[model samples]
Target: MKQPHKLWLRSLLIAAAVSVLTIVLNTLNVFEIFENKTYDLRMANSAKYKLPCDEICLVCVDQESIDWAKENYNWSWPWPREAYARIIDFISAGNPKSLAFDILYTEPSVYGTEDDTALGDAEARSKKVIQTFFISENDYDEPLFPVEQIKENAAILGNITSKKDSDDVIRRARLNYEYNGTVYPALGLAPICLTEESIDYDSIPVLEDGTVLLRFTKSIDDYLPYSAKDIFESYEAWKNGEEGPLSPEDFEDLYVFTAYYAPGLFDICSTPISQVYPGVGIHMTNLDNYLTGTYIKKIPGYVNIIWLVVLALFAALIVALSETCFTRYAAVAIPAGLSGGLVLSIAVPVILFNFGYWILLIAPLSAFIISSLVNIIFSLGAEGKQKRFIRSAFSQCLSKDVVNQIIDDSSSFTLGGKKFEMSAIFTDIQKFSAFSELLSAGELGCFLNFYLTKMSDIIIDEKGTIDKYEGDAIVALVGAPLKMYDHAKHACAAAVKMKKAELELNKDIVNYASNPKPSWMEDELYSAFKILVANNKTIFTRIGINSGEMIAGYFGSEKKKNYTMMGNNVNLASRLEGVNKQYHTNGILISQATRNLLDDDFVVRSLDKVRVVNINTPVQLYEVLDEKSCAKEELIAYASDWEKAMSFFTSRDYQSAKIALSELLKKNPSDGVAEYYIHLLDDYFLKGTYPQEKDNEGVAFNTEDGVFKLLQK
Candidate 1:
């Protein structure tokens, strides 16, 4: 085979694989939302196409009709069955081709048996009336049909249930429903069966599942329905030989569909064309589609695969046959061309849709996108020498994600700063200086690597950007390079996970102490290590998160600049990590800005209001409880008492808060957070000051705002 043929084969294989995956995802309903929206857009854009154009009309039991009935007949809704009898009489006089009542009379009328008999007589008089049946969820094999008298007198009984897609949008019209081993036509199908249309009932192209892709056109405004009140007036006028808004001529050979449209009485469904669409209008649209023979049908699974492969091969051939100049310009012109072509592929479904067929949207589009990306990758490989040099230079300094991002689009990265809302997390080991003395320099380096690696994995897994690693600390940001709406939530979750991870890492260290030392280790060194392990001396880290607008970019000389964040918001996050020390807490602490972004699923409790050094504005802090460390029951009880104590403290009732904290300490004696607040209360009441601190940055409890101000860092 020629080189072009090989390229085509490769492209075909890639498309086939992606197409199959798309099919699997689609079957699992992963694309249901996107597909429904796409269908709605198509319906809104398509030209208005009417079926039985001159024959079909809707007689809605609108609010006006209901009010008219109440005043004229001296009765409210659930009106006597005789009222429908009169409607039947009026519509029957017009000699319509089919009169479908999209209503169900499943029980005897409240008026009397006489009213039921009267309605039954009228239904019998109209040879074209189609009654509706409801398929109850409790039993699909046996349908809930209209009352026996009405059913026996009707021309045909049809199912009224239109199955909605998973997204609650009705995109398919059920053609028929089977009950007790007998298949019955649907409400929409009933009219087609009764009309003089040229459809072969036995051989229509209905799916084996008895459904057809519902093709909607324009909007309900396109088919202006005649009001039921107007039709009743016309009937009275015709009887009295007087002129009215409606005439018998309007109903000649018409397929009239009557349904209640009074809000709370009629079924309101969501559709592509309209969010709150009337269910009756949907049935009318389905009926119209059937009359015009324009119902959409799905392309078979195998046929979809074939279409994908053919399109992919064609695209690949276009690229492979390109001359050297085309390949040289492929970097710019080819991508632009491919983008335009991908957009144009949308027209395939749109055009084929007119012919009553639907092509899987995601499959072809995925093939186009993936194939283009593959071709670019292959082209890069063809220029391996230069590309490798670029990758090697950037790979060392930047993360793999940032490197790939720059490689893909270098213009996105710039030295100029950009301002955006982001969530920043700052973490620090509780006592890093002590770790240096505990471990030799080499062991400390290895330990730090292990800790950082575990923390980095959690951040990256949450799609957070690792800003930089300060010694014994990790600084990360969410919502950069790629925007995330829930950046704050992600950052907070990452903080919680890091705290949990530290606990697990410490446990691993304790477990590892049992392992034998290296042959080079002397007895004294081994004994010292064993003693450290026996004492359960392990690292504890504190995390803090804050969310606010920040400026992010490189800041340094051109040769040595590093990409990171710098702003008041970023500093607040750093301060929060340090504030954990003041609380004597070794867990995650989040500023109010971050707390506001958290959903109800996170377990957190308000810690305090504090003014960190250099920032006069008071920030509210919350402690995010670890799901593993704290039992749910204990956390709930602790949070209740903790909140009560803080409430008293905030109101300047130090004695009450003291009593509350002391009571809480009885149950939760090991809670450092509670003990820390008690100590503050004791010092303020006795010494007239907080624990010893720098003069300018002295920790002072403010009575006016109930905020603890730290005057020094």
Candidate 2:
């Protein structure tokens, strides 16, 4: 398969696996505790924006009320039933719709039968009152019911058993409880069932666990509270036909829930809004939810699974597309895209919660997170493999800097040519065939390896790319794969460094004779080495450098391509390497184009204007001797004299040129350039075959090309 198709298929498989795993875990309720925590967080934040139901109020028998009753009425811990009777009478006078107690009254008051009778008589008088009962699973065969007096006289009875999840958080409310083939409405649900005569209990939304998700719209503090002691005091005053602190308008048409609120009562538990919450608050919150029609409805399990699968696939798509992008920015963009996907996963559920729906958070979040992370790992592994391939393929011919550049932005280094200005260097050993003939093939190979290693090290150090090796020649280019504006200077610098390395290697060869030969050395090879040292003959390299516009990129057939340069400029550099033999000068030669870009750090001398084979343009050549700071004083003086001689020759002053050239040769006896010029002058005077026509530059030459043609003698 193609790479992109394989990548996409792999992404799909990863996403599918993650989704399936998350769904299975969710089905098993593995993330129940964590999912509940996230649900609570959303509830707490969304509750702040909703207004609490004003029709419901809490009549709390808190510590403050108990203290007041003790201080004023001398009431003890279990305040007399007569006190509750008075409060009931007071609230009943206001004509409330219904009143319920979150507290259970399964047993008679400890004060006395008459004491309980008093509360029973008052409850019987108020038909709107609803009494509380308890239904425990541990006692399912035998449940606890309110006393006969309270149960018989009250309007209705409800189960007051508060249910808690495994995490000890009360987020859902049980709507009903069954005991002995009879169903009892929960305390919070009883009032709604009693007030709404035509209510259908089955129509109410419930989870598969047979509970309703409570949307707590208010905190405990948000409910209006009436202290029990205050209500009792106001009841006494009103019985005398005197004005009371409490009025009937306060309870008119309201549903009042009364329960214990003191911390010492041990009726507190953890809820979404508070870690320490009153048990009464849960009933009140459930009542408020039912009354306002804002109870949370859970999204179906199948629907959530669908959402999980969709989210996983979406994340996979993003990763697959990003992996296919062959740009440097993909490195950064992939992470950002994954982060956005994760944020969307959480945001979607929270947004749905605001509209009264509870969407499971952990499953979808897990799918998105796991899928994104796995795909990222896969992409990184693939990229690492590509980088390894690039390093292995190019490390031999390209410098470390250039190889790293290609790795960083491989998009820029593709198949095809790019036209740009670059410098090309061509190097060949002087008389390598004759040198090879003197030694065996194995010996020649060893010598070539050592010499080439030294020269290639210098080129790589200057950030040049070795194009190829032909016998003893090395062709290389600069300012390709990675562009360097100072390519000409780098090329020239490598050439000078290579020449210096050559001198060092020659010294090593000469000194080899002083040391005893190794035991492994063959007799014929040892003899050839001694002969070379006795004659002071060493390996020499001729290099030519030229800088101009050329096409640089991968070239050749698809099966075997190379990163190299082409065009006339590259050819000219090769021809210049051969020109060093005809001029009888130093081994390094550069075209005028390369010389023009070189800085003052290098010292160069002009050779001639010559037309090389196969190139129509006559190019000026310069011999690169050494760096200005390292050039020998005698060689510098010889260059100065040679410059003077070239000036006279170009100006058609043949006699003066001949005299100057001879004097230069006399001072520097090894100066082959000066001797060659002197020989040319002698030929011109004897044969009388020199050109008489003057070109625009005032130089007279015999060739129609208007340039010198010096061939190998």
Candidate 3:
């Protein structure tokens, strides 16, 4: 090789060595810095996966279930003891092996205070949750457990927990735990072995190293594994009419394995459902699957690693194909196939074969596999026609990764792109035209470039892909490039950070006369730039976010084109940015789509229904909180009240709407959205088109005649 080539090779070798060292150090740090995660795995199995044996599940005592039991038993209060007793009796009747209760008797009982010892004694014995299993290590390095009364009656499952990873929340429960000189099975295992002859701890299949293959069983045709409530409710509804709850038969043979499924009530939370499961219903589903021979997808560690690498390769291929073929169709089809293949791979083996597995392909894998396939095809000259489509589909909204994901997956690359769900963000510097006139071209270029760079950086940093840069605006996407785990969160983060950066930039410029007093000089410069005009200089930008289905990908004329998204959702996103001004807010306005996807991460206050130029119907609007200190409950209450008032105003229920608005103002004295809508409501109810009647939903109606009229059909 030439000297240059030799030197480059040497440098690459050195870099690789350094990278390896860095990776090793990072892995070690990951172990040391994070919480221990062994128990998390156990919890995960308990929540989602089924044990080898049947009959291990948590019967959810939902409000509906409780209500049904109460009416029949003439009971006024919800009690865990009665349920426990019923479960115990049922288990005894079934004459199956073991029984475990995933509950904790952490506190003393209140039922003991009653005269009838039946209620009190039952409550006390219900603490026999310990009866379900043996306890895990109470002291470190020593496998230890105490055999108590319940342990004698049924195989007690010690619902023990270990520390979690510091950076994440995953606990891997130890299988075949050892305590002192004794080895004990997990409560789940213990119960199964005791109840059925099919499972013998000593005889069960095990790896050469003694570990049984643990896996998830999933099926596409089946919904998320059903909880006890689903079946019980169905049965109950069949017996009780439409407005009914569970019936007596619903409780028959209801061998309940009670545990937490409710957020505040349950002990486990790692299911695909909410971080805090609503009830322990997952346990019941798991038990049902365990008994009936249901399973999901699983990939062993070594093989999973291989798949991960393959997917990465696929992702790389997608990028190449997109650049080469330049067609949207190829990009789209590839990813679709990969995602489908992965789902199928996971479903078929577990659901059909009665084995366990997991769709080992991570989000990135699906993104890469499909994108690579299509992009490869599109890159070919014959298919390069999709190039214009590529630009059109993603130019203004997606990040490079998302673009690459689209390129990698033929499914995402389409000339006439199909509708897919995505989160769109539109940001515009308010009054940019006026701001530009105030400065020379050089000054304006510097000003615009600086703002755009900062905002775009923020967006990219928050995992958003920049779609394009319009004169005074920038549009981007969060879910595309790859459907992110938390696109809304990333979008919200970008909006907040961009606004923050603007304020800091202005602070330094405020004292510099040569800088010509940064036009967006409001307290929150970035957010106030176009909207916060100061001394005829407010060039603040407004941001709006809407997440929903939109026709995305490259679609345009061959000669002149770009990648972009076009649809009602995208339009709504653009409309929302301006909506901040109407609502007199500084940050993002979210749609219902955005709301449904969120859990506890956001604090949003509702704004009035927007009467945009072309849209006839009003949409619910919200102002997302930038700080955690913002009271979520109070904000929700206030916003809900305002929305109620808006409803009254829409229906021309002037009196009711006014009352609601006035009530909201009482809670939040300077609420801007409410105030503006209140004025509009008066005029709308009195003069605009709406029925003058007060009902539960006080609403005023207005008809739009412009661009919005076209959408009515």
Candidate 4:
């Protein structure tokens, strides 16, 4: 392949990996779970406005209808069968589509039932008059009504059961049902209204699962029963024989909810609707809409996938741009993009919903998140790659010793999967996120490659393993490929040496943002931020050292492999580095196990039984206070201090531990990570809730071994 093609292939590979990873992560629900959440203001908006759509047609027995039925029928008893006759008579008079009743005649009405004789007599008479719609719940395609009534009217009874999620919020309505292996349209479903338009029932979509295959056509208002609650209740008054309350025309053309006023005969309960939705009534409305040809929801599937992918790719770009730039700009851009995506995604569907079209919103969001991840990841890789090249080039030029050291640790250079059992050190240039205040990518990369070459060289000299350099942090591991009985000692020594070197380098050339004559300065800064990728202010590392059995091999294919560790110990080491922040310490924080293995003359202080989220029990975090002594002494002292603090902290004597840590710290003023921990505990243990998830830099503890681990860069 041509160079351009190879570059394109590389970009494509990155994109494909991002796509696959997004899907995998989404499957893992990582983004959804860790994603920052925003409040749903749409619910408030929904509550404020009733869905005023002209789609679903209405014929409701509103609150007034309930009142009328109450005033006349002895406070709304189940209507005498004759009242239904009147409703049938009124509806039959008009050539409306389909008359649907949201009521169930599951049992015969009780009239004069003191004795079976009188009850039998009334039942015979009532059944005789309205037998047409005594529609039994059985397999039948045609309406089952009293013979004479059938001659006068044609209808379908509502057969919808509104269901909610586990949260009791009704968001879906069942629009089809099966009986005797044959599909039957639920009386309330819109297709039943097709009877009025004289459309064939087969024209509508039906899923094999006996459900309505949402094939909505036309606007939401085109179907009726769209009355406000106040308007639906008037029909009860018109049902009684004494006097017809509404004009016949009102009753004639209307598709009223022929449901009872009693709460037991439900049409008033709520489901998981957007707002205060009357579940049964809203269902009736939905069915009426289905009947009148005003469908809102569409068939969900692959057509939406294309848009989903596009949007996701777009999201990746937005996020990548954000990460590639300064945090402040990223702050504004990412959240705005995320929020805009969320709102536009949901709002478009809602607007379409109002317009009588239904579109799936959730899946699209899934796509956007996938896209954002892609862009951010790919962009970061681009930044890091440029930095890495600069690193490879400059270290070879800077000092032959550094270059030699890097070559010695060449097995651990790959990014995605490389492993080492050495101590992993994380250092940030402190506010390196500010470098782009006005610098281009090439300029920035040159700036970072400079210091990265030097600091990283010192680490390499100590036999450290280099992991990928993050935008501003160089994560390297020590004690791998070639282990030393005193690996922790070597790592600790190197950390101090590296820090001292960074300080020395910082003096010669101050302002790294300038050009070529100023090239060295730019390279230094670039090596740290863009190329070297330092983490934060003043070049200092948060070192987490856990040691145990770790893989010193390449992971991935021969085509593209990285020397990364993949074992329980490696993760624990990463967690420990992050834990440095909790402890408020700098350089060389080890696990309890690492301390246990070393000799006893040097002094190492106990940090705490720091809690990492993955671990239920806290691991003892220790600081290597004095690297000059035998590794044994520092480990022993650190182990002993933790032994004392753990006993105190476990008993919940947070105060005692706090003071003890303070004392330990006073004896060792160079420690920042540990002091931070003492204060963290003072602020936390005194409170009632558990502390937040561990940002122990990436530390994980092996209780069985009592060690600290730093597995990668």
| Candidate models: Cα lDDT each | 0.71, 0.77, 0.49, 0.48
Q: What lDDT score is found at residue 244 in candidate 4?
A: 36
| lDDT for each residue of candidate 4 in 192-249, tens digit (9 for 90 to 100) | 4444543354644433443442222222223344232232133444455333334445
Ranking by lDDT: 2, 1, 3, 4
The TM-score values for the models, in the order shown, are 0.53, 0.53, 0.37, 0.38
* Comparing 3 and 4 on lDDT, the stronger one: 3
lDDT of 1 at 200: 59
Model 4 alpha-carbon miss at residue 509, Å: 77
Q: Residue 412, candidate 2: how far off, in angstroms?
A: 38
- Clash number for model 1? 2
After the best TM-score superposition of candidate 3, give how far the Cα of residue 376 lies from its true spot, in angstroms: 9.8
State which candidate, 2 or 4, has the greater lDDT.
2
Q: In candidate 1, how many Å is residue 650 off?
A: 37
Candidate 1 stretches with Cα past 4 Å from truth are: 1-33, 47-52, 137-142, 195-199, 318-325, 382-713
Candidate 3: which stretches are off by over 4 Å?
Answer: 1-59, 65-83, 94-98, 113-155, 160-176, 196-255, 260-264, 273-355, 358-713
lDDT of 1 by residue, 336-360 (tens): 5554656555778766666667776
1-713, model 3: which lDDT tens digit per residue?
Answer: 12444433443343334334433433454322111121222224333444333223345554544555566555544363544555444333333333355654432333442322332343244432323333533465433232232233343444343322342232222235555566655443444544455354344334344333333322111222223344444444543555234333433333345553321234433333223232233333334444554423234546544444454444444344433353446445444444454454334323422334442322223333333334334333543546545544454444677666665564544233446677899988765655655565655666677678878888888887888886778988887746666777778777777777777766634434334445654323332333223443644668989888775555332112345666678777877886676556765778777867766666666554545544546667777766444445666565556566766755557788778887887787776666766665565545544322222122333344211111110
In order, what is each prediction's RMSD in angstroms? 25.1, 42.8, 21.8, 23.9
Between candidates 2 and 3, name the one with more favorable lDDT. 2
Residue-pair clashes per candidate? 2, 0, 131, 129
Cα error, candidate 3, residue 219 (Å): 11
| Regions more than 4 Å wrong, model 2 | 139-141, 382-713
Error of 1 at 370 (Å): 0.7
